[model samples]
Target: MSKISAYILFLSLFLLAACDSAKKEFETLKEGEILLDINTEEYSLNGTVLGKTATDISVIDDVIDKPLYKELCDTRGKFLEEALGNGESIDIFELAKLHVDDNLSYVDFYKALSSMYFCGYSDFNIAIGTNYKDVFQLSIPRTDYMWCGLVIQRMKGLRYKYLRNRQKLSLSEMSEIDVEDRECVEEYKGLDLLLSFYRKDDGIAYVVSLNETFFNKGSRFDGYNFYTFNNDADLWKFIEDIRSKVDRQIGNMPGKKEDKVLRLLANAHGPNKVMLVFQKDVLMKDIAPIVKKLNTYGYRFAFDLD
Candidate 1:
């Protein structure tokens, strides 16, 4: 045989092997179950890694390591806009499947699954463990409108965090966070309005349902305490209240305005996440000042829905 012929045969065999491997990975995924594998050191779905795919050129505009999460919202929002034209609602799973292009990676697909809660697809049965064999087929019962459940399984350290309804949440759980026996949830009722999972040192997952009392009396959870704010005035008043509790000279130290403010605030409230709860009538213009101040001084803030 000629050298060129041998080389061509070898190349063809290699391509066939790669295609077979990709097919097996896809076959491992059951209906309604998303497999996000981190065994390749990068987030991979089936055999496609986010940055390794040709379609990932569009992801260059996104933040580092956060491209999928950002794209999850952007892509799903556009899909919802087109799917629900002049209609009140549509089947989420069907709409999602239709919009998923051949170029979509598994990481983006899993992130998209998590983003479904934003479109009111809340009910989910999440199970995270070491390998794909531990993942069960997600069975969502039919609701009055449609089926409303998704099962997400993380094979390894895929750094995806589902921030429920908020742009930023300090308490949100990242997919890679260690869990013995993947005890996050056997059957999470739903990621309804304010449902959150708080895992303690003892390895027990606590289902926290934040409500009006969280705003009125602040949150004291997991050995951390912090105040909540409904508006900019509430934030400033809390600042002033913190000032009153500390020594005047210390709180009003010269050349240390931001540091003094943070120190006193931390002293009054533990060094934990500060909650910002905007009332229904409050506009962005109303809370802009608070957000700016928090950003200016590097405050760890968490915004919650009313």
Candidate 2:
């Protein structure tokens, strides 16, 4: 081959490779608003990329085949707009009372929402786990009028150290309970508040049903303990089943011993999705049944192994 021709061919290949790398790292998405038609191995969904990081992108838009404004959002669409519009400033700590105007299209509502808070985005369509045998179909919804959940599991059993010259909590403990978990289970100032967030100007919101909150509180010792899913019998059953399998595996381990209580923290997400942080090592198969069940029910999962 002639030197000139060979050099041209090598440059073409390099450009192509660089383009592909940019797509994977989402560098291409940062150029402008990108309309992505995604079919990830886990699920299929569409979104518009509004922002990007070195490894991830922000979904400022959701694309769906049908209108889910009514079935998806428990409130009237107009109410949602009023909550955000009204020409009034938003207090991220307010009760989020419903009050306002009569109409706003689904697209406009979401546009306003994304402008006010980042709660409106989903993590694109990443699979629950990296590798698994089962394949569950995907039915991604337009969450314009709806909310999605984020589960942050922390299993570092907590304790109440009464006194010893007004001892303060370590930074790690504070981070786990306050910052990492989004203050879901918090002792703010002095009040024990089992707070559930729906909108945030500087933080994130994870929806929690009123019934679920009452149930979690009922299961606690003094409205401040994290216990099993007492009200969610079916969910608890699935969790216990997974726990049984993982427990047996731990039993077979040579010299490992229990350190603290087995903690699983899942902030109630919009979909039935959850994020699990574990006390012991767990294989994909160990939790396959529930994971598959959730997938079957149109749910997704993300885990924190650290």
Candidate 3:
């Protein structure tokens, strides 16, 4: 074939594949139903289609319940036991003494350290308390990028659930608009489950959209997340890193979900908080192992679908 004809053929194939990529991810899940398949890197975990959206998907993860908490407490405790690499217990009161680096002033260092260690994750018993006063708050210092000039590590599963108190921005307002022109995002052409790690002003955030992002035109979610991270550079880097990944498989595809559906109730909190909605034959399952796969890659979900 001539060079022009060869190029035309390749372009046609690419467009066709791009159009079908989103639909194909759905087809892969429904061996029968929208059976959820948590994807780690090794394989796909299949389950009935629990919840879906115009351009996103979600599976159940129940690492927040008590029985499961009881089951994993020893393991978590063991991890805590090895805190700071010294295998010593860290008391909350002594949190101000943590000296992670030279640049971190004692006050800012303590604040970051407290954000990491305080406000109980294990205390959650299917419901999040109504007050942000008790919630763990993270501060984003000025930086060239998300963490470039800041001396901090983004925490996985970290949440800034204060969206309930903040005013809700309509989908159009919250959408990430390109100042230059209508954004033509490079379509995600892979069938891999879309999981992402993000840095927000309030804390590190995680998102697992079906195949599109909150900013994608195809994404029809009515919700919008509140942002306190005023650093434009940081926000740019966060979204760019997600959009530019060579592949979206952030971790090993999860296997089977265990028994019981562990839930975190931001009870009084408005239900519109969750961006992706998913459900299944109700009951808690072992979310720890599957969640660990995402955490290993630094994506942790903190809210729930009520």
TM-score for each model: 0.23, 0.24, 0.20
Q: Please write out the lDDT profile of model 3 over residues 65-115, one tens digit for every residue.
A: 222223233434554556647745454212111112222122222222223
Q: Which residues of candidate 1, in runs, are more than 4 Å off?
A: 1-36, 45-47, 52-65, 85-133, 136-306
How does each model score on lDDT? 0.36, 0.31, 0.29
Of candidates 3 and 1, the better by TM-score? 1
Q: Alpha-carbon error at 37 in model 3, in Å?
A: 27
Model 2 pairs whose backbones collide: 148-270, 149-269, 149-270
Query: How would you encode candidate 2's per-residue C-alpha lDDT over 1-306 as one tens digit per residue?
Result: 999999999999997787556445432232111122212111111242222211121233342212222222322233446656666433322111110011212232222222222322232322223221243322223443311122121212222221112223343554555435434433321111121112235533221111122223233212222222323354446444544544443344354345222212121232134433321223333344444655654444443222
Residue 59 in candidate 1, Cα distance off native in Å: 18
121-234, model 1: which lDDT tens digit per residue?
Answer: 443322222222222222232344322122222311111233222333222333235333333433221111221222245542212222112222233211112233434465
* Runs off by more than 4 Å, candidate 2: 1-133, 136-271, 279-281
Every candidate's CA RMSD: 22.3, 18.8, 22.8
In terms of TM-score, how similar is model 2 to the real structure? 0.24
True-structure lDDT of candidate 1:
0.36
Error in Å for residue 118 of model 1: 5.5
